[model samples]
Target: MQQAAPSASLPERARGVIPGGVNSGQRNVPGLTDLVITRAQGASFWDSDGRRYTDYHAAFGPPLLGHNDPDVVRAVAEAGGSLDLCGVGVTEGEVELAETLVELVPSMERVLLTSTGSEATFHALRVARAATGRRLVVKFQGCYHGWHDSVSLNVISAPDRVGHKDPISTGILPEVLDATLVLPFNDRDAVRAAFAEHGADIAAVILEPVPHNVGCLLPDQEFLVTLREECTRHGSVLVFDEVITGVRHGLGGWQEVAGIVPDLTTMGKAIANGYPIGAIGGRADLMDMFSSRPGAPVFFAGTYNGHPAVVAAALATLRKLHAEPVHEHVFRLGERVRTELPPVLASLGVPAVVTGYGSVFVTYFMDRLPHTYDDLLDNDTRMFVGYRRRMIDQGVFELPLNLKRSHFSYAHTDADVDRLIEVTEAAVRAQLADEGPLTDMDGTSTMGGATRC
Candidate 1:
């Protein structure tokens, strides 16, 4: 795990050309030198200097079967050679992909293909508003739906800013901000209150059934049940934003795990096994809003919506996931991660909480697992961020920050999990030994030994 800064000139080169030296705002962890990864394969990727990392980033949760999975790659290549984009009528691949989704998802009576999860989610909200004739959307705080105007408020805000309509991005209109009502996750009482106040005017209640965005905070059964009951009682569409969790749990996604059907579901990430694709599916009557027969039809069209190569990749990905015990394997790996890491932290006197479900997990800097966004405010995030950088230097690709989830794919072997625990222990010990006199993960002062990343 000898370290080298990634091609030292790359960051300067990128900043000269790209905004913030990156396309996505979150391309770099806070304290690390910016990197340019050169190649990726199963369960690992390499930086510009040929340093290989056991990748848990999973391309931010798309590569469930891991990078360059043979079947998905083959499907994409074959389709690219034959027909990649047919800008005419539908192809069998698209139709077959949709059919596969509908068959797998219990509530997918109808389906729409889109280029990204953001598009799928936007259209889902559109369909909900169109069908219900309501404009208000109820979303949980810290639950990120997408980059669209409607769903972009209150994502990972500071402690005092909870429930405030502070758009995380600039240029979001006041009206768009006004249309969204934010609440804390796992708060059934707040759900009740919001619905009681604005149920009649609410178009949809959207959230990740298990929120991966904020360190994998889970929905209490009561919380989820209340959402379902209230959405049903109020005629509001329940939209599950399963962009990260979709199909990572199973063939049918988190909805299958929860056993509660959302009125509409937006899916991406693991849906295509790293291919660029998205899908929105739900009840037939509501899904029909996109049809031409409607007088004011929801205009859901994208030239690349059903791109053949990506669709073929998605179909092949689904085929592999369905025909194999992918989830079982990954779930066990996830369990191994959650189970194994804490002892190392405890033995080294680092206070931390490890929480996750299925294949998505996070190592929080807090002493206990957090229940709300505000609770995360006091966490010694500086410590965890440094630990993650050390882990990267040890050739592991956990994102070097708090609040970002670590994704384990089916390609992660038993050896990978063992290596993960080993490196994490080494990283924590090294981090602790380098700096002196800082707070433990419990928010109490301790003799520290680590320098900042």
Candidate 2:
């Protein structure tokens, strides 16, 4: 791949204008200069320097159907040309989208649309508290539920800091952090202990049904079943933060896979195929709290909650996802990447593990796949940075940080996967030859050059 000239001028100017030379911190890939994307289509994006690369990140999991999908684009443009925002009123598109969602996820009887995943989660937590009359909430480490202060605790924190709760942001009040409990994911014992201590006071236990942050970590069947039973026993609401995993995993999500239902499930990202939209839906009884009655205290309102354009896009995306059987392609593509990529890394004597479900997964530079944020932190960071730079240079777009994960979409083909794997293999070989072996931040080589699969 020919090296594109670095466009440092815009980012340098942005440093003084924008807070972090970017709107979102996640967009700022570390080490290499930030490449500003100018245009995107199916499975690829063109940076400001006119370099095209296969977009494996998929805009952090929203582009399930791919960037600028023609169907979604047409829907959005047609809807926006007429009705853009119909606040507080029932639009035909909104109603149809809601109906589509309810039919797709049988667990979701009623759906309330919002603008972003964070707002959906915030509103869901509020509904849970109102329904249960409890103040406490529980979440697992490494599971990011957007930027809300409540769910911001324990996300991607250092492993040495485990067992002690830490807030990701400074503005989050100590009282708020106190109200939210942090626990290790895939560990029923930690959840059991937390419930034993403060189960009665807990309003909800919110978690990413399939955690994609800090590398993809899937929960065990027993762990999910135990959560359902315990939440039911304590009369606490179980909230599945399926913002990333919702339609990406399947039409039904992890709940469908695990055979357990959550009282409330939050969905975003691919729900609208890159359009900005989020939804919280589940049992009708719990969702009834959002009723706009004259006397009801519970309030959930957003000016653009069900914007017509987004609704139109969502309805189109969902219909296409189901009608076209996108999940089958996603699963097939995911299997190829996960199975073939690990051995390529191993052949180069690079220790790494590919962990995740469906099309969204992460290649962690570790020996054993991580179970907790602590375990993830024990993996190689410098090696990941090096590999990311090399992969990017080789026309593959991946998250440049160790803690962050990569995503794939339905738009990806076998050729895309092969290209990505080839570039990854080259990157792994380069890193191993140049750096000898990858080591954790603490300079440990526990991650022997071996494949966990």
For model 1, residues 118-210, the per-residue Cα lDDT tens digits are 898999989899999998998887788889998887776655566577677889888888998988889999999999999999999999888
Minimal lDDT window, size 10, model 1: 444-453
What's the C-alpha lDDT at position 346 in model 1? 88
TM-score on alpha carbons, each prediction: 0.92, 0.92
lDDT of 2 by residue, 125-146 (tens): 9999999999999999778888
lDDT to native, each model: 0.82, 0.81
* Per-candidate total of colliding backbone pairs: 8, 0
Residue 107 CA displacement from its true place in model 2, Å: 2.3
The weakest ten consecutive residues by lDDT in model 2 span 444-453
Model 1 clash pairs are 433-449, 434-449, 434-450, 435-448, 435-449, 435-450, 436-448, 437-448
Question: Which ranges in model 1 have alpha carbons more than 4 Å from their true place?
Answer: 1-10, 31-33, 292-296, 436-453
Candidate 2 clash pair list: none
lDDT of 2 at 377: 67
